[model samples]
Target: MRDFPSRRRGWWARQTPRRRVFFLALGTLTVLIAVGVGAGVGVQRRKDNGPAYLVDPTTPSGPPPDAYPPNPSPNGTVWQPQANSTWQIVLGSPITIASTATSTVPDVDMFDIDLFGNSASTIATLHKLNKKVICYFSAGSYEPKRPDSGDFKKSDMGKELAGWPGEYWLDVRSSNVRDIMLKRLQLAQRKGCDGVDPDNMDGYANDNGLSLTSDDSIAFMTYLSSAATSLSLAIGLKNSLDIIPEVVNMTHFAVNEQCVQYNECKTYTPYLDADKPIFHIEYPSNSPQLSAGDVSNSCNTRVDPVSYGAGGGTGTLSTLLKKMNLDGWVQYCDGKSSTTPTES
Candidate 1:
């Protein structure tokens, strides 16, 4: 989701040696807290006769096979992103991924962009540059502007997404919808995408006319997981916190928006515990040039380690400061900003 726009302020970079040391120390402290709290919670749950929620760290590598369909077929190696991997997302414009000797986007590890708009050659170019491409698509909603919009059954369409004209939520329970999403996944595979970022997943939380519930989300995510895994394409849950406990094992990572502003970063650390990344974005509605306070509030938002930390406090995050439109412009925690070259 795009964030509300903040007014432009005097933006500046914070690359001082002292600030670097502070961030380094904060990272170490967060790790310690996470470890200590994790053990304590595990023990307490056992003592309190509560459900054992923590998965055994040594159980196996990758997501649980049970989350996928039976007898799934694999195509090739799935690109898994680390929690610390830096990224840039340009959904509003199809930016140039492959750089010439004269120009290039910032040297980030991954580039997330519109799936339907991007060309296979663009994805191939990113791969040639040793970069991972996460294709973005609307899995839970129907956009009338899409090329395949006519394929959606009339009965499967629900209420329009508020503020987004011509976009409506899809009934996740429909097999027809699933079939369309599978085609989208196939397209992503053909385009050579490393992973898929399916958006508008939290339709149940909205005033969706479909009477959809969290269970529907879980079922849909499961089906998507099975399809993605079978195609050897990694899939991420986009901003659906309620389904994390039920579907985190199936998800490769998370695409989160404004968790710090909403005071919900703690809920998403399950990805970190599962050794997956949370690609986070925050739109400072107050100013494009965020003040020091804005930076600290966004970057240092305390993540609780009760379910997920070592010293008993906030966890570090990989965050981006961007505008509401989600254009090519991006700013890191270090305060540097740049615009990726977008196609007109």
Candidate 2:
């Protein structure tokens, strides 16, 4: 299994044969596979978990006074995933969210993607298909390879992201930072995304070296919310459990990484209670022990239990064990797997 990560690394290295295609795949946490174990499962909006968060903007008062896009949609307001909204997130690379992904799970809701990697036409394609698009960008950390990486001032950078080498903590407080982020939002708008998913906002919880405060994070989120609003796009507060109450109103949805694993799903309820969707992802405990029963959830399944086992895992994961490239490979919590690949 030691050779597995290296083997996967080779895949990306070879991907640049035509053009240097840097990839950012989610790291597999082999340790957590056993966590979910025999926990009984089913797709749910979390029943009466003590009145979830107030996420719905159109309260009994009838949609907040905030200005929204002029709706010309035949269906009225654009697509926003509610409790039962089916969704998928793949940041590893560009995905044909509209024609390809939508064509397959056209019935599902919401497709969160890397904002920088995807092109404007790609986003336009999704909008043409009448699908809600979520543009993803690293809010706290700055990847050195991004198109606008050079735009980030060295003074704005802090320390190397503890584990990620080419990345570093960003001073979310700087006006320069705001400018770069605003540019990203503008890109999202030009691309036609329905929303934005600014990741790594939980810098306050990490050794960001930026001395970032919860208030700072909140302020940054507020800025992002305002930017999204200007573009008529919804924005999500990505995995900052501590500030949920503070920033909940500013953002439209919540994109949680591992709520159950972190025992913080409750903190995310505020968004859910408000009728927003909590896009979740859990890792497989054992890379090699994938059972046929793992299909219960969209995540927490084995790659090839027979060859990999309960712990030994390999290959690029798609969506749900989808693929390293995040194609159509889906591994549900029940261990059921399928790769409905689109034409490359």
Model number with the top lDDT: 1
The models' CA-based lDDT, in order, is 0.82, 0.65
Write one digit per residue (lDDT tens) for candidate 1, span 1-344.
Answer: 77533423222243467877888899999999999999897787556642354344554353454454433224466767887688999999787754343324777889998999999988878877778999999999999988899999999999999999999999999999998999899888888888999998999999999999999999999999988987888899999899888998898889889998898988877776666788899988764777877766777646646545433333356788888888888888887778887888
lDDT of candidate model 2 versus the reference:
0.65
Determine which window of 10 residues in candidate 1 has minimal summed lDDT: 5-14
Off by over 4 Å in 2: 1-79, 97-102, 105-107, 287-289, 292-328, 333-337, 340-344
Residue 136 CA displacement from its true place in model 2, Å: 0.7
Evaluated against the true structure, the overall lDDT of model 1 is: 0.82
Candidate 2 lDDT tens digits, 1-344: 25666577785565654454223322233334444442222112123221222223334333333444433323334345565465666676576544444463433456777887777777676666666778888989889888999998999988888878989889999999998898788777767778888989888889878788899999989888876676677888888889998987777777765554455555555554555566766554543345554434434323332343233322212224343345555555435554432436
